[model samples]
Target chain A: MNIAEALKRTFPMKDLSQGKAASIFASVKSKMPAFVLKNNAPYRAVMTMDDYEILEWAHEYRLTHPGVVWAESLKWESEEDKDDHIALFNRLEATKNSGSLGGKELLDAVQKLAAQQ
Target chain B: MAEVDGRILDAVGRFAELSFLRMKPEALLADLQCLFELYGDSFEEVMDGVVKALKDIAQDRVTVSPMKYDLSQYSCYHFQSVVEQGQPADMRSLFKRAEDGTLEVEMIGNRFFPADIYTRATERIEYYLGDIGNMSE
Candidate 1:
């Protein structure tokens, strides 16, 4: 299920103290899920180790393949330049997300794009 | 008058010179705070010696001011030095006492260099003051 559904199923959206939140996480850690917690203010999510690992892996992937990640995406001059870069990025993202592209392939794709400009 | 350690004075002189030459204010303040922490129980005495030594070397170029903030948990001191001749190159250092009783110092102004230079300068300062064995990182 989605994060919202998972959170709703797990815990009530109420005034949860830091201590209560810790206890809740401790109780349900075996499921390795994510849940939302609030303390009379803004809501925050407490992610399980497995979910955190996934996020860490995604972060590492973005760092390794900056061109494919939107935040670390390339800067382009003109609208046409941006379009070209986005098109190259799309292809790179597809290959990357599919797990079909290795480090060498990713580098080759980036190098090929650079060579074009 | 209790004599200040000659070696400590020498290190301070070298540190001040290097700070002026390299133009790294943040590093200078950070190192200064670290230097104060090194002296531990002799903080007040060491600081008194430092002020005297800096005044002797820097002449009219240095100024020290006591500062107090409503939100701060401890006493604060401000130090400023005009290190360069032209274009008004000045660096200000603010030292606030931490809850643990050690002073925490931060730099103000002198924004020409990148952040990485400050980090490297900190490392260099630690090495320079290596004999004291209070170098953090």
Candidate 2:
């Protein structure tokens, strides 16, 4: 089902801009339900809402336990050569070519990441 | 995937450090490069992955005040009706399952968060990747 329909089934919502709908879809993807509306019908994609809620709780759970996690160690690659720059550029370009996942999920992802220690 | 994973961990470390101290997003764009790289293909997939991983890390160790958005507060904004509430703590395969004529829904309603939450979050990701404070260490 498209996002609008899916969302409609879950919540009493009004028509949303594609951008806003897309953003909400991203935010809720983490252990939350998101929907797309197509021809006024709900289509399902991604995980189940129950599962998404679990993930959301997990994020909340992590906030209380900050000592168990460990951080990774990365040495700065001091490579500023043209090739390295080009590779970074290539990666950026590749990602752009695909498209961006904006919305609340993106924002949630940001919040969850910030909570890490 | 190995290169990407490595870079992701590196950046995650930086984000962790920044988050530990509640820093801002002045350097968020730079710090988020690690997350941006890992989430290279689909923004949704990568973001979902980030949420999962961050939650995992938080649960494993360290303790901080959690930033929460009340699902009840912004109930009006939701489009879905019945969100599949999973195990209270497990986040492995949670998703929005569509039923006969309904779907689960929740709105973005975190009140404690600031307007620049995303920017701040990116900085946290950078701090974790950079291995700045590392309180556990």
Candidate 3:
């Protein structure tokens, strides 16, 4: 199949112009994450209801841990780079080609985080 | 996960130091992260428990005071839900497992926590937040 046919079968990837013209969330469905592209790169993601609620629960739980029960230390090269845990995790998952997570550092940080678990 | 673990402790320790009405989202975020680490695949079961616990506590937790601390002294709301485990006077940590292998949880509150315990309270709070309300339904 051609590129248009391939895109239709795999995902209804919409461009930013389309996102502006219509409700970006109009086609969202459970287990299907809708993508919005800008300059042919991922610009935004819209999740279905079930996915959104899971994120909500995770947000609630993270805000209350450890002092009730846990603690530990981290020694990371990029530790000083990003203090935000979400950003830090993103960095950990990033490839060096994307300018982060230089292999060893991510492994060390994940190991440190997984030690007690 | 120990780093996540300690960061969470730091947040709750700070939360315990503050008034209940001033609950910090920072601390709550830490608790959620630690929960993800602890339960992994079965985290959903625990979330259901949390929903149940919160629904019950959210009902009548306002007017009455906890027996452990006077409102004038300590602000940690160690309600009957936390203490009636009857397990120990000092189950100081947050999570415990029930006989059926389900996870049990506790809140962070104390009458006399040391000032030295929460030295990281001054750390910048940059946690990103989104609407907690389910938009699907």
lDDT of 1 at A42: 33
Candidate 1 lDDT over A26-72, as tens digits, reads 65553455455445333656667777788889867755554333312
Estimate candidate 2's alpha-carbon lDDT, on a 0 to 1 scale.
0.34
Candidate 1, position B37, lDDT: 34
Compose the digit string of candidate 2's lDDT tens values, residues A1-117: 565655554522343453465555555644446554556566444456778677678666444322212111122234333243334333332223222122333334444433431
Between the candidate structures 2 and 3, which one is better when assessed by TM-score?
Answer: 3
Q: Per-prediction TM-score, please?
A: 0.24, 0.19, 0.24
Residue-level lDDT tens digits of model 3 in B16-101: 33221222233344345645454556545444444433333434443323222111211122233133456332212222233543
Candidate achieving higher TM-score, 1 or 2? 1
How does each model score on lDDT?
Answer: 0.39, 0.34, 0.36
lDDT score for candidate 1 against the true structure: 0.39
> Model 2: per-residue lDDT, tens digit, B50-89?
3443443334332223323321111121111112354122
Candidate scoring better on lDDT of 1 and 3: 1
lDDT tens digits by residue: candidate 1, B17-126 = 32212212223333343444344565445455445433333333434455433212222222323222563422333333335433333332222222222333333333
Report clashes for each candidate as comma-separated counts.
0, 68, 21
Misplaced by over 4 Å in model 1 are A1-12, A15-39, A54-117, B1-11, B14-90, B96-137
Poorly placed runs, candidate 2 (over 4 Å): A1-73, A81-117, B1-23, B52-137
